[model samples]
Target: MRLLFVFGFFVTYGAVLTATVNNPWPNFSGVIILWFMIYLITAPARRRREYWENRRALQEEYWRSSIRYQNRYRY
Candidate 1:
């Protein structure tokens, strides 16, 4: 299922991050910050994408229904 896939992805990422932290270049803090930033950027980007997609579908439906109604009343 989708949940399983998501869980697996996080587990894999966490393992890699653990390794990165263990042998971070110069320091461990930057790797942690980079991972946090990745989550921040990706979460909002996915949400914004879904919001726009729904708005586009609704606009298309409105236009289709308006055209149907206008055609029904034509002389």
Candidate 2:
């Protein structure tokens, strides 16, 4: 299912590029900039950053505690 979708997407994208790209370099560069701007506009900011930081901190603490527990048993 995922492979079929990927193939279909590439086929559509290639057709568009063929029809539109008179100057291939500039056209491809413009497409890349357009996608980058779309990503910047749609991506979340502060809340997502805080959530990820908190999750990372929790994971680090878990690993540290587990290592300490193992060392205690070894001695």
TM-score of each: 0.42, 0.36
Worst 10 residues of 1 by lDDT: 21-30
For model 1, residues 1-72, the per-residue Cα lDDT tens digits are 984676556655665665654574343354566556666767987799999999999998898779676697
State the lDDT of candidate 2 residue by residue for 1-75, as single tens digits. 974675456545654664554553335554565555545764677468888999999998898779686697685
User: Candidate 2: lDDT over CA atoms?
Assistant: 0.63
Residue 46 shift from truth in candidate 2, angstroms: 9.6
For model 2, give the RMSD to the true fold.
6.3
Q: Pick the candidate with the highest TM-score.
A: 1
Q: Against the unseen true structure, what C-alpha lDDT does each candidate score?
A: 0.68, 0.63
Candidate 2 TM-score over all chains jointly = 0.36
Candidate 2 Cα errors over 4 Å, as ranges: 1-26, 45-50, 53-75
Scored against the true structure, residue 52 in model 1 reaches a CA lDDT of 100
